[model samples]
Target chain A: MKSNEVRVARFDGYERVMHWMAALSFLYAALTGLAIWSPVLYWMAALSGGGFVIRGTHPWSGVLFTAVIGWMFARWAKTMGLDADDRVWLTRMDKYATHQHDALPESGKFNAGQKMLFWSQVVTALLLMVSGVVLWFPEWMPRSLRLVAIAMHPLAAIGSIAGIIVHIYMGTMSVPRSMRAMLLGWVTPNWARLHHPKWYREWRGSTNLR
Target chain B: MLVAKLIDTTLCIGCKACEVACQEWNDQEYTLGTFNGSYQTMPDLAPNFWNLIKFNEVQRNGAEAWLMSKYQCMHCADAGCLAACPAPGAITQLANGTVDFVHENCIGCGYCITGCPFDVPKLSPASKKVYKCSLCSDRTAVGLEPACIKTCPTNCLTFGERDEMIRVAEIRTRELKADGFKDAGIYNPAGVGGTNVIYVLNDAKQPEQYGLPKDPIIPWTVQLWKGPLKALGAMVFMGSILGAFFHYVVFGPQQEEAADEVE
Candidate 1:
């Protein structure tokens, strides 16, 4: 029989819903964005109804995605703040990559990797929104301004997508227990102890375990 | 045989008939609204707007000049968008050398956003799809000129075989030089593995003068990183699935290894 261990809620119902909403919107925006960027991926139109439909949807959805990310940032900004331990953890990422569990640093609510992801998403979300608006209303601005936005938009998108690819991999596959936190809103005490010892201790002190 | 477009910027009158014709013939929507002094409402290509007429005012030798160019996909032979796309059916090159889009197979990953040098592709927010100029493949299949070329009142845009387009561009360049335009030249013949779209500049301005890259090539780091990273991600996903299956099948969903270690 499984032990009856109490696990504190890291994400409330609203937070969890927002988290998945942002994720789904981001995924959709990323795909449509790629389709418009290359003829090689033009077939993506079939997924969204047709090419014309894809054209109509890409930019508006981008707005929604950006809006949701903004809300998420505001809600989680305080918790995602980095500390000295996080810096040290980031510096030793290779150990984590190689699956050296013992060599990994102890963390609080979020590990160094999670903090890095949080910050990266924040930066990317801002860049995409700003650059997107510039492109949307190019005639209102000077030609030079539009050119700069065009150049920056692609560069920012590339960097963000690369960051997101790693993020999804880590969230879903590399760390088995991480997904459960986002999904069911609970984790085993052993998992909390191993991954986030500080949070585990704090939670244990505040609430009794069965 | 790659089909291409030869655009004579010198002859372009900035009437924007080509822009209108393209939208009407392709059945694309008029997404651009009046903003600047000109009727060319389109600022850039979008999912709905594939072709755009860019108007630039330049001062050359103390003389005022209006530089007009039609912007669209270059349809590069080694298209960065092609290499970067995760979906197999999103983009394809036709047998006649035209880059084609198939919306059915796209997952909208936005990889092509960084892959394109010209920044041609655009996403639609309403339907979550990509859109760009398809060179009027449907029209071209029946040997009809593209809507933009057919509608150019100044006879500025011409479509033909790639080799023939280059020849026309060269002849036009010579004519411009003879007419005392020393900087007249043909653009993008050999760059980016040669582009399907050719341009004829009236003045001595290089391609960069018209907002094009002098030497457009895919970034080496993007190429190097994407292939291995994708492979590693796939491997990890597959490995996890397999590991889960093996554990459930062999150990009947409850492994004794943890218990043995505790003992």
Candidate 2:
């Protein structure tokens, strides 16, 4: 039971849809990508009709994922900007890892962990896109260039996947009530207060009618 | 059983019939690129195109050289992408040692992109799906050769049982070594749990000479960061769910007044 007095819409309906779309698309890319890469999960191709289907679907879904993530970046990049508090919070990540909620520093709309996830996504997305393009056009370029692209693409994908695992954990499991913002586009006052007191206060102080 | 490929680069004529056949058999469209280049039209593997032939010009032994090889999924045994996938239906292993993909169960996290050692998978923009080469599973289901194998004018690519392929690769490597290729050897038999697609290089050159990794391993960070965190997160999720269920069952629903008071 929580108070309903301090309610606010943290995300718009479109934003929530985009967030989920990005999430879903990214998931598709990751799974099929793995199926193509290794025999250990070659069975995954059955999900897409077979290995060929996974192959056909992986890149197109990646493009869609990148597009949606790009939209999410535009919508949230400003709020996700790092600040002094974020630095302090990042330096004290061990507290969060140990589940020391009381010692956890207060944050804004996005915490230090969330900000790191955002920026990692941004950098990895750029790297995957660039490397993917080179891979896509190997015949058009010199072999040396194609080899470089091949090497860089996998490395970038690996880093991005690792970042995403952390992002998913923080968003869905570790932080209570955080997923509700993305799910319902709103947050209860108490939840906002507990997790993002600064953002809660800012929203309370705002003169906007909504 | 460890599967391998013995790709004889010398046998490759750079005709690209293999690429065309793969596209045709897979019902993929021709990926046309800039017009001014040689017959190297289909640029690379996309969500649509699963296979491609790469052309390389190098200064080998201080002499100008041209090299060509067909490229597709390597099908590593300890696939990074498989280990990284979060969804259950995303990736699976087949009976014949081929890795497969499932689309209906996919949630599109893109974890596989990072897990792959070869970076083979590509994302499509229009349909929001992921795609890669599956080694012609459809054709194999009917006991037919892969389209690329059937259409290769030079017989550069071959498909067969995993064990038989490895045996042939070894014999070919030995023969190539006797034929003046002192460095000829099979690639990726034990590298990543053994690749199903084997390569027979043109000469006794390192795999790096033809743009393949000498040693590919799942990145340590995956084990370090994702492996443990995913397990811990699942535990938390289950614990939270069970805790909420227990609280509701034991304490019963809260009265409106009590709920209001807590708030």
- The candidate maximizing lDDT is 1
lDDT (C-alpha) at residue A7 in model 1:
54
lDDT of 2 by residue, B88-167 (tens): 66677677666766766554545556566677766666554567787777777687877888887776777787788878
Deviation of model 2 at B241, angstroms: 9.0
- Proportion of native contacts found in each model? 0.00, 0.06
Q: Write the per-residue lDDT of candidate 1 for residues B1-263, one digit (tens) a residue.
A: 78998888989888888778878988876664658775466566778888888887667789876688888888888787776665666799987778877887665545565567677877776655677888899999999978898988887999998899989999999999999998898887454687888889876456665667777776553454345544553455456556545543543321111111100
Misplaced by over 4 Å in model 1 are A1-210, B39-41, B108-110, B189-191, B219-225, B234-263
- The CA lDDT at B140 in model 1 is 93
lDDT of 1 by residue, A136-191 (tens): 55334444454455555556666666677666766655566677789888876666
Against the true two-chain complex, what DockQ does each candidate achieve? Answer: 0.08, 0.08
Worst 10 residues of 2 chain A by lDDT: A137-146
Clash count, predicted structure 2: 67
- Candidate 2 per-residue lDDT, tens place, A12-80, comes to 999989988988988898888666544456677678777546655777888888888889888889989
DockQ, structure candidate 1 = 0.08
Instruction: Show model 2 residue runs off by greater than 4 Å.
Output: A1-210, B1-6, B34-39, B224-226, B235-263
